[model samples]
Target: MTNELIQAQFGPRAMDYVRSSVYARGESLGALLARLQRDPIRLALDIATGGGHTALVLSPLAKRVVASDITGPMLRVARDWLAENGAENGLFCQHDAGLMPFPEGTFDVVTCRLAPHHFADVGAFLHSCVRVVRRGGCVAVIDNVTPPEPLAVRFINAFERLRDRSHNFEHSLPDWEAFFSTAGLRIEHRQQFRTPIDFGAYCDRMSVPERTRTRLRVMLLQAPAAARAALNPREVDGRMTFDLGELLIVGRRAAR
Candidate 1:
């Protein structure tokens, strides 16, 4: 996907991310804090920080935290949000995930939460994450992942793309492992969560057209066995709901 498209898709809807419960308070965010509590984080970077939640959370832990996003409007929103939260050390930057301008070993920790799936070249983004972090520092990512089955992968990706034009491929666990390894980061921590997504709210978050919403509902209700197995689609209290597989993986740069 082009950077222009990504900016256009997310800039105007930036506030929606701030209001999103999934982004503002997710299990993965808690997991991140728990895992990094004991580590020393002097300078941290939060890439693709849509609403600045991760960066804000990292503020009290790291001596300084930089919230970076490709969308100018997103950065502005995040900057204001972080300031409102009294994150005195929080900083803002506008940059592409795949092409960070920071020097090598510039940060003690790097984080990307629920945003890598939109990256055009996930490997390049991971490499940039690894490159910017100091030796022995960790790069953490939390994002939706697809099932290993090829059919399910295709179906889920199609389902996502139907809602948002900027939607990109959500890779499988194995693909992420390979990408991390190839980027010179060694696996340190890994966890998965069955993230519940309300079908209606999900569509509304992207402002999906009414006709497209109908198609999405049909896609979920009539998904293939593999897709259903992966998503765990079902109805709850007259509302359609499903689980999206989210992986929180942490990889550390080799200390050599």
Candidate 2:
């Protein structure tokens, strides 16, 4: 699906993902919520904010939350979600990850969870994150990544593209570090996070076709032993059960 087509895909399933424990309580949002609960925070910008999971968790802790996405329907659904959830501190706006419509140094904290890989330009996205955050403010990012091994990276990325056309590329650790450093954001914390996915639910989330899903399953099943070892495809009841990996990267904007 192109970005425009998938834009429609997200809002319709917004509630589905919001209610899904796999997504809401999964790796990225879970870590973000944990950090907020442990400390007082204010004035956050949740980039992408698909399903509003990150915004919902962080809104209550902040004085104000500006959750932005390129998709209008998505922002609408997120606005509705915040209203119903008693999170009056939050607000929504249309924004592209590669380019945002906000003034500089406006927010104390910024977050992009499980959504960066969809950006057609990752460097521009990170720099935009840096631009919005105030000096000494924190920026948190979360996304799936492949291991450094060449074969493993190619296989994982290719499978993801087959399953979800909107997927761009999952950056490696060095790529992230270099981007953040040059963007003037210091890496504050890094965690290799994992979230399990039953094969069917994962495919369905992206609305993958039956034929493509079958192809993905066969690819995983027949993967070279080394590749399979890295991906570790598993099954229960003779059906594909699990295969997913994620990462959480927390950074601090340079002190002015």
Q: How many residue pairs collide in each prediction?
A: 0, 0
Query: lDDT (CA) for every model shown?
Result: 0.91, 0.79
Report the C-alpha lDDT of model 1 over 18-45, residue by residue, as the tens digit: 8899899988899989887879899999
Q: Clashing residue pairs in candidate 1, if any? A: none
RMSD of each: 0.9, 2.0
Model 2 shows how many backbone clashes?
A: 0
Q: Give a tens-digit lDDT track for model 2, residues 1-256.
A: 2568558667666666666667577756677676656545778999988778788888878989999987777787778878888899988888678777889988888888878878888888889888888888888888887776778778888888888777888777777888789888888777776566778888877778899989998988887765576567887777676556677878888887
Reference-based TM-score of each model: 0.98, 0.92
In model 2, residue pairs whose N, Cα or C atoms come closer than 3 Å (at least 3 residues apart or on different chains), thus clashing, are none
lDDT score at residue 123, model 1, on the 0-100 scale: 87
- Model 2 TM-score is 0.92
Q: Per-residue error at 115 for model 1, in Å?
A: 1.1
